[model samples]
Target: MKFTTALITALFSVGALAAPSITKRQDTVTYKIHDFTERKYNGVNISTLFFNIESPPNSGGNIKFECAPFVFPTGKTSSTFEAGHVYFCYKDSPYSFSFVPGDAQKGTWAKLNLWQTDSKTKTYVGDVEFREPPCRAAGPGKDTVCEAQEDYQIHMSVAGSPTEK
Candidate 1:
């Protein structure tokens, strides 16, 4: 009876000592606005390639999508960039902002292998391509700041956004 009581006491002591050491892994990231896709038809891109995303420790993360674009005819060049804001606690599974099913980015979404956090690079390169929808009356025109560009092909790695943990 005495031995049994001693064992129980020791176990409780160990549990109390070890409980405080375990911690949940947290990943924090921040990305800023860079430039638009490197294509001629990118006139339709929402000025900012993507919004600033910051997945904070406990805020369930947050995303600020800047779905804005230039109002006038803007020539295509890597140099053209808009002054945008940076947001944190944010986060896409699809090529879609709609999340309907097939990404409306172009009606199709191919899961990129670079979906991993370790896949970070200065510029993520892939032979990305998408279908093209000719400019129709209901849509943008040939030089009208409204063009259907398949922008998934090349990704610029310009520190694309400075992110950290």
Candidate 2:
């Protein structure tokens, strides 16, 4: 009996350590976009809001987005948008984004697909991707190579609506 109990406890402890931590934020929370390395991005206007590279000094802080209920263009009502989705408001207008895997050509950079947020039916605006600088060897004659490590990751900040403040 003692052996069995000890084994079960050990297994549970290992599982807990292996599992990734998850955070549940309110729907009205405000968040900022960043690369996996936690490098902040500036909102460069391409067609919609684009965060390609890290924010430069004196360029202000990171651009923020909201996770709030959106009002349909029909003005019928406001409802919570889809899960795993974020809404970015630019120039008093809201836009949505989706993540897509890169092709063989663009090895590490992932595609960020944009959507026009007005009506319930989303309009396919376009897509933008963040390309990292080419990876080089860390030091003299080493097998290890320091490659670009940007991925589809987001960091949330304070609580607020999708309005850019």
Candidate 3:
């Protein structure tokens, strides 16, 4: 029968070009804490939000998202505050993160890098709209105040595995 219908349409076009369309994207990341040091961090302080994502020939892997929970007041800090919804890649390269009030876990994880709003799309996906470096307290007894929590900014949606390079 025409070689079994052309070998079942060339095996469904090589299984849709070698499969790799796994996806899951959610957004709502906003964490802002500015403690000019009076030394408080006592009333409410819990943190963990690291999200560094790079999508090149690395193609996306099995990743998931959604993490939220924060309330650090008493020392005071807020440029905004929603902080949550960040998933990570499975095999590697996609440090998605989230934390707050977590048992025995208290503040420190402000890594940033997940930017690529639109470079044209080959599809690995990364995007950050938060910029830092206005001269963050560097002198004078410094230690300033921006008490980690992955230092804030993450909300992307990109999947991987289409014969990843």
Candidate 4:
């Protein structure tokens, strides 16, 4: 009985030491848009904009955008308006702005678009667009090389206003 108990305890100790604990951190990113250009449209100044987006660590092989209007020229007479379609690019990926409005389907890809807030709910308005990465032809009889390529870009952008939750 003593021998069996000692062996069991030793086995348990070895099992505990061999076990590995893996912790997964959540990847949530923040995006901002700025550098609004004032253009004369019908004698009125319209805002043309650019964006800066920060990707969270461990982006989970994807980028997400939530669109909403922002309060500009803050305090007393802060103007709010709906911004138009935004654009993004990833340096590591070979994807283009080929995303369409819809959920992800097989071979379907997407990116985020920022919009204005809804007056009633005080929530930002926006939609997600799916897109596919650009394709490249492999060298003669070299399918393995083309198939192994991966995306590595690390930046994204929009046309007007910042988008967040």
Candidate 5:
């Protein structure tokens, strides 16, 4: 009976030791507005603009926008935005962001065109493509440095009054 109890205690200790850490590594990336316009298309307010990027801690040392275009349709008109805010967060490493439309625009989204640079020569680091959707939920045990997936969330709002249109 004592031997059985000892074995059980040992097993419990091992299980406890094998548990993953609960603490998370968090960082924020900010993109500032370079330009924006408020216009009325039909009767709806449409705002589009470009933004400059500020580098995050682990973002290949510097920040620069890649030349990938995004296409979207608003009601009867199709609009293309050359630039806007691109916010990204990573747990272990490797992250991607794809745009998702709000309640007003359904089935409309954009994918970010991203690339890593040489850090010195300011050249491309091989070829890195953005593949994941923005603000998607992440799973457990995914917050590792060697893993190629990370979780992210987004918070956004219109800057002007509704009556301005």
Candidate 6:
């Protein structure tokens, strides 16, 4: 009985030591509007938000924020950005963003993956083409309006939790 008990304890100890340790970290990132442009199209407003990653000047770093163009249908005058519509450019790098889903005014949770394909898959294929939309806003809100882009100062926050092993 004593030998059997010792063997079982040793096996359990070895198994515990072989197991990998996992740690989870939650982080929130805030990005500022470095540049932006808005234009009216078919009675609807189209806006493109640009953010420049902070890097040493003259470093030749190619870090950039790549995002799909966001269209604000008629009656969308909140000036707040929609969730799951922005992506960071880095060789199809995978990233996740957590934010308030629907109406920013409503309390809802939404998560977005940069390389999300279909409903439940993310594929990191290759380089992504970067296309910066044109800036043009005829009247009304001037901040997003390219005519007064110098005064633009909007900050957006994205929260994400990643597991580390």
TM-scores of the models, in the order given: 0.20, 0.26, 0.21, 0.20, 0.21, 0.27
lDDT of 2 by residue, 67-156 (tens): 222345644212322322454432334445554333347466655544444334323244445664233434444322222454333322
Model 1 poorest 10 in a row by lDDT: 92-101
lDDT of candidate model 6 versus the reference: 0.32
Best by lDDT: 2
Instruction: List the global CA lDDT of all models.
Output: 0.29, 0.37, 0.32, 0.31, 0.28, 0.32
Which regions of candidate 5 fall more than 4 Å away from where they truly are?
A: 1-49, 57-60, 66-98, 104-165
Would you give me the overall lDDT of model 5?
Answer: 0.28
What's the residue-level lDDT of 128 in candidate 6?
17
Ranking by lDDT: 2, 6, 3, 4, 1, 5
Answer with 3 or 4, whichever has the higher lDDT: 3
Model 3 misplaced regions, further than 4 Å: 1-78, 85-113, 118-120, 126-144, 147-165
In candidate 6, stretches whose alpha carbon ends up further than 4 angstroms from where it belongs are 1-26, 47-63, 70-165
| Residue-pair clashes, model 1 | 7
Name every residue pair that clashes in candidate 5: none
Model 2 TM-score is: 0.26
In candidate 6 the C-alpha lDDT for residue 153 amounts to 22
User: For candidate 1, lDDT tens digit of each residue in 1-165?
Assistant: 899999999999765543322123323223222122212234443222232222233545332223222222342212333323221111212111210112456577322211112333322212223343233233344322223343332232223444310
Cand. 4 Cα-lDDT: 0.31
TM-score winner between 2 and 4, please give it: 2
Candidates 1 and 2 compared by lDDT, better number: 2
Please give, for residues 1-165, the per-residue lDDT of candidate 6 as tens digits. 999999999999765433322122123222222343433332233333332322233533323343333333433222344444453332232332222222233543222233222123322221111222334445565533432233222222222223211
